[model samples]
Target: MTTEPCVAAPVRRGVAWHTPLSVAVLCAAVWLAHSHWPLLRGGAGRLAAADQGWLLLGATATLATWASAALAQQGAVPRRLPGARLVAAQFAASAANHVLPAGVGASAVNLRFLMRCGLPAARSASALAVKAAAAALVRVALIAVLAPACPGVVRLPGVSPTGAAVVAATAAGLVLLLCGPLRPRCRRALAAVGGDLRAVHARPGRAAALWGGSLAFAALHALVLVAVARSVELPLPPARVALLYVAASTAAALLPTPGGLGSLDAALVLALAAAGAPGATAASTVLGYRLLTVWLPLVPGLLVLGVLVRRRAL
Candidate 1:
């Protein structure tokens, strides 16, 4: 009885704290939108001048990403998931992704969904890691293949030997500093991920879905950017644009940003400029891309998330 009260008290307090925080965040968003309405209006006007067909194509690709994500999630585990619910969870996860840094929100939603589907917590986490690893590998592979076709599109900045050595030394020092405290936990996590990877790959069907879906997800994202560029009549070839998208995304992934918001926008703008887009054109292209991928689907995605929560599906 005493323990029950203690637990309930903390739960109540947590809810109390969260309610006010949520309201504060909502108010801040509204305030920012109102203050920045002119910028938003200008971006919208630019998008209005873009080719509608290409914009539609970008929107379609954005919608397809959620399905690809669900497929990859299923491929990470041997067990069959309820298909519709899985896709819905992915849609909800997208909205959640925009709220937390480094994909934490989406991962949490998927982890809970997997647990609801009966997997143990450790297994669920391992499956998520497998999916993430496959996505990273696919992104790198796409960049490698596409980058060569567009010569000089992505140039590595020349770094002096001294600078390189300093960076390497700093990385090594950081690793050594944390290694003692984190090594055991990291080892256990890696072992679990390795076990899951082996098991998932042993089944050819699962392996195909894992890699194929990851590829499709990355490709679709690139396609969204390409479509946006084309809509604005940007002079770059579609292939080159796709390559730039993949490369910029890969680099931006290093930053722990919410859905790669600021990091991705800046990287994409810089990449487009490097490819010869005028400043205004590059900014408009990015604005269009974000309109299709983030803002357009946000409200609906949040609704889906709420439904899933009410049904206890996540």
Candidate 2:
């Protein structure tokens, strides 16, 4: 029933701070959308004539992605969330994810939900962190497993200096997390996360749900991409297409774009091209993938988000 004190502080600010930040994020999303509009148009034109059955299948898989996310989120915590409401929260979380950078919006929503479900703020955050870490690990593992199966699917593109610098900075940050001087609360958070990890794994069902749901989430997303490619008559095999999705999505994660908008599109297009699809097919594939995954469901997702908020479920 109570919101986090930190969360309440910002809410009390009455959009004074939120307005500018929201506008900035919205502007960035718009710029990226505008730049990528041509591909969407081209993809739409092709999809207009695409196979409806496969497109429908892609849509089904996209829906499955939300379910998988819900399962994974539930697995992260010990307490049970009402199944129907939990899934709806995840649906709303997906919409929130598109509005904010990285996943701040989604995390805020889920954190509030977990707290309302009777967890303390620290445990709710730790649960979220554990779910995120498990999902990320599963994704990388899938990429490694699939990359070898499809020999040429991933390539060592020449790394630019900027990319190298980014990698170095990331490595430095990781090292700092391990050895840096920390405040008492920071140290406690690390302890809590570690404890949460062990606690989740100690329960067989939780462990299975955590890992299994994470795997399913990644697989469902890749399946959606594969089905979209098929709908547009792209010639790649499903396995190869799935490989490309995992790799592209993993790479896109580094960019921190909302819902992986621009970065994901670009990486996916490049990945498909590397997989030997024709230019139009590759473009159409990316376009169709985004359409099913992002555009088509955006409005409904937002509406669901609003309903959840009105109900105080998020």
lDDT of each: 0.84, 0.81
Backbone clashes under 3 angstroms, per model: 0, 0
| Strongest candidate by TM-score | 1
Candidate 2 deviant stretches above 4 angstroms: 1-45, 157-178
Tens-digit lDDT track for model 1 on 108-224?
Answer: 989988887877789899999999999999988987898789999878889999999999999998798769888888889999999999888888888998998999999999999
Q: Which stretches of candidate 1 lie over 4 Å from their true place?
A: 1-40, 174-179
Which is the leading candidate under lDDT? 1
Clashing residue pairs in candidate 2 are none
What is every candidate's alpha-carbon RMSD to the true fold?
6.0, 5.2
Summarize candidate 2's per-residue lDDT along 1-314 as a digit string, tens digits.
22222222123334344345445545545565677677667667778899999999999999999999999987787666778888987887887787677888789879987776767788999999999999999988998898888887688789999999999999989778756665566889989999988888878887888899999999999998988888888999999999988988888888888888889989899878877899878988888888888876665666676666555555
> Per-prediction TM-score, please?
0.87, 0.83
Q: How many pairs of residues collide in model 1?
A: 0
Q: Which residue pairs in candidate 1 collide?
A: none
